[model samples]
Target: MIPQLIFLIIAIAAIALFTINIRKIIRNINLGRPEDRSDRPAERFMVMLKVAFGQTKMTKRPVAAVLHFFVYVGFIIINLEVLEIIIDGLFGTHRIFASPLGGLYNVLIGSFEILAALVLIGVIAFYARRNFLRLKRFTGVEMTKWPLSDANNILIIETLLMIAFLTMNAADYRLQQLGAQHYITAGSFPVSSLIAPLLPNSESALILIERAAWWFHIIGILAFLNYLPYSKHFHIIMAFPNTYYSNLEPKGEFSNMASVTNEVKAMLDPTFTPEPVAEGGKFGAKDVTDLSWKNLMEAYTCTECGRCTSVCPANITGKLLSPRKIMMDTRDRMEEIGRNIDKHGKDFKDERSLLNDYITQEEIWACTTCNACTEACPINIDPLAIIVELRRYSVMEDAQAPSSLNNMFGNTENNGAPWKYSPSDRFNWAND
Candidate 1:
């Protein structure tokens, strides 16, 4: 009963902490401007299903897709065992489901064991790809010491967790063979049977191993749950809604602000009067708060895989614009602001912002608006959208576009084309 009481307390505390962390993230995401993405429910659901759940985009890289599929699917399926663990922790019962399920329980246990093995193998491959194989996608200026260490830490934690699970099963099976009290003779253990031989024959030693492993596994899972929000693995939870709220319009189509649309309308038609925009309204995003909630959500959803950066034409051509860095910077800045709000209250003012402070004007301008980054993102993270927003802020609000772009904008306005000559003189170039 004392053990059960302690488990209950720890479980409650872990869950509460996880809830608080998630709520903080939600608050940070909500700090962004609201843009309605609630239209087309069925289409959004399909997008989430295909991109987030099916992981269709990842299929382009077959090897990576298969390995990630094992980790993703295996983790989710194996966590079903957590349910049994929770039940046993609460009631002081062992193999609680084995009695009623009978042979089906054995099938379930066998499947879980197989998945755990696959997950372990997948983790090893992933670690090798990052550290040993030195994959290009995992190497970049953005892949700093912390990012590398964080990735490795999660991999090591997962490997240990899986080993602990298997070890627990092995020791439990050994106890069952010894006909120990409170050790149920249920569930098949194909993987653990081989491991059982290595465990101690003494009942006290076996019980200690089994109990220790069980405690470690559950405690590790609770720790991992809270750690998700701080790591790139937050994508595991953010991917769903992030993909669901995906921009459904054509990649090339830029979404216009309502006031800007009104101004454009008045320019083309004398009878159409433009509505007055609010005095404090800004032209474009200058910070995380100026961005749409979807953009902020995409920031949090980033896996930091660098696939987007690897495919970026600007980055490939030696420009300093890394799409992965853009998302990481946004997330980092947002988290900082969240902490500020927590400390000083929401009304506190700060001069720092996501634009020039985290991402520079040079980086924003390097973007080609090609959407290649968006295409490469596994979960539909639109890094180009953030770049566009920053560019808009620079050009419109600050009037700080590069000379070439300013020249083009001037020519387009004057001659109805992006050239030095007038519309009537366009044929003169042909004549030349």
Candidate 2:
């Protein structure tokens, strides 16, 4: 009873902490400007099914995809065992589902053992891919210290949790062999059966080891739950909604800002009178909050897998641009602002903006606007949109465009074309 009561207290506290952190994340995501992604419910549902559940994009990289799939599937299936653990923890009942599940429980446990072993192997491979293999995508400039540490930490935690689970099973099996009171010979642990012979011979020692392993596995899971909000692993939860709400329009389509469009419409209509620009109102995004909510969500959804950057022409050509870095910078800035809001108030202003602070003009100008990044993104993250918005702010608000762009802008305004030649001279190029 005492043990059950202690487990119950820890579980409840973990639940509360997880809930609070998830709520805070949602609140922060809501800080961006409003966007309408409510159209086409059926299409969105299919997209979520294909991208999130099916993992269609991951198939592009076969080896990593297979390993990741096993880990993902194993993690989900292992949660069933966690459910049984929770029941036993609460009721002080050992092998609570053994009798009812019968032979099926043995099958499930055997499958879980197989999957757990595969998950362990997969995680090790992932660690090797990052650390030993030093994959370019994984070791990019944006992947500095914390991001690299976070990736390794998640893999280590997962490997430890799987080991603890197997160790606990092995100990439990040994206890069952010794005619222990609470330990049952119901579930088949194929992987742990090999481990059982290596455990301590004493019954009490085996029980102690089992208890320690059990506690470690559950507690580690709880810690990982809370850690996701602060880690790139948050995509495990956000990927579904992110894919569902992805921009479904043509890739070349640029979102027209309502304020700018209204101004342009007024200018085109001679009957319309120009309204005075409101003080502090900006033409384009100067900070994270100025971006649409979808753009902000894209930042949160980034896996930092660097697929976008791997295919990015700018990054390939040795330019000062990385689509992956742009998303990371955006997320970092948004997190900074969120922390500031938590410390002060929602209306509190940070003097630093996304432009010239988080991202530079050189990086912005490096993009070819080819939409390759957007196409390469597994979760439909559009870093290009953020780049465009920031560049728009630099041009329209600051008027700090480069000399080449300024000349093109001037030609477009006067000659109605981007070329220096007049309209009548346009046919001259064709003749040449």
Candidate 3:
């Protein structure tokens, strides 16, 4: 009766979590806009296969990558053992792994325990690098706005999982003492018959303890599942799609400009003038809606790991451009715009919006169009593109370019290059 009740509870909870979370995931996916490039059906399949299974980006940091991969595989395999434990606590039988493949099950469980330990140690190293060593070369001066809640939560989750494994091992040892068949595989999992001396002689107490541990483990998992979308763990789900759909083109290609109809007609009628596809046309993003859906996803998928900022040449060179902050700012602006649009209609405009007002013209131009940020990003965010778009807006529409840029533009119009030397200077270099 206890087993049946536990089974029903777990089934119901699992169903509820999947239903709620899956709906939210689908909604976020649907919000994505169409890409301007030609769609290739095969490209979608290739991307899905590569990112979901290949784990290509993780290879950037080999030690962390390998450790993470082990943890990921262990987490998945250990879930089967969790189900068996759940069943054993409720009923008299651990049917799932008790048959011919029992040896395989023991081996997997032992390996998982070892991998879990390694992951915990790896996470500790990561914390040390971020906090103590300060790893300024990889991470900037540590910015502690919220006291590392995500890291702490991950640690707590791992600790609880490790405890669950120990408890399961203890329960198994007790069962072996009570005349249950012991199967040894690879000698990795050392069965301690010593547990029999510690546990009560009565089977009832053993059953009760097993049931308690089972409840604790299952509940922990359910809670983790629900919390995933809200926490940094959301990257676990978003990372694949983000990488798969990442921009493959050069960072310099800011969207294609709309074609100008007639240069003469556009010049004659200033109001009716078609903005220069290269100049006056909508080059950079004017508002949140102006951003492509892929860009929007990039914002949401940021893990705030500071990996991009660490690799940024501009940040290294003492410029104010932090790639991580740029992504965050864009995300904040998009959410802010979304909230305002919701309160007012789509047509409603705020002329005095802080999104536009706070971000300066100079900061946008400081970017050197370096692809380092994009290359370093585990989720394939392109901060370089955002900078370029903003520069396009400043140059073409407002005519508010930097002095250097103004001089360049003037030279380009006059003699092609920004230099004051005559056009004949190009052939003069050839003679030399």
Candidate with more favorable, higher lDDT: 1 or 3: 1
User: Best lDDT goes to which candidate?
Assistant: 1
Query: Which 10 residues in a row give candidate 2 its minimum summed lDDT?
Result: 272-281
Candidate 2 residues lying further than 4 Å off, grouped into runs, are 272-280, 427-432
Q: What is the C-alpha RMSD of each candidate to the true structure, in Å?
A: 1.6, 2.0, 5.3
| lDDT (tens digit, per residue) of candidate 2 on 1-432 | 898899999999989999998887788788788788999999999999998888898888899889999998999899999999889889988889999999999999899999999999999999999999999889677888999999999999999999999999999988988989888788998999999999989999999999999989988898898889899998999899999998899999988776776688788997777666432478778888888788888888897999999999999989889999999999999999989989998889978988889899999999999999998887889999999999889999999789999999999999989978878877786776
Q: On residues 4-43, what C-alpha lDDT tens digit does candidate 3 reach at each position?
A: 7867677688769877766654444333344553466477
Candidate 3 total steric clashes? 1
* Local distance difference test scores for all models: 0.92, 0.90, 0.63
How does model 3 score by TM-score?
A: 0.76
lDDT (Cα, tens digit) per residue for candidate 1, span 1-432: 999999999999999999999999999999988888999999999999999999999998999999999999889999989999999999999989999999999999988888888999999999999989999989888888888998998999999999999999999999998999999888788888888999989999999999999999999999999889899988999999999999999999998778788878998998998778652378788999999888999999998989899999999999989999999999999999999999999987799999989999989988888898999999999999898889888998999899999999999999999978879977776776
State the lDDT at 257 in candidate 3.
Answer: 45
Residue 121 lDDT (model 3): 68
Candidate 3 C-alpha error for residue 389, in Å: 2.4
Q: Rank the candidates by lDDT, best first.
A: 1, 2, 3
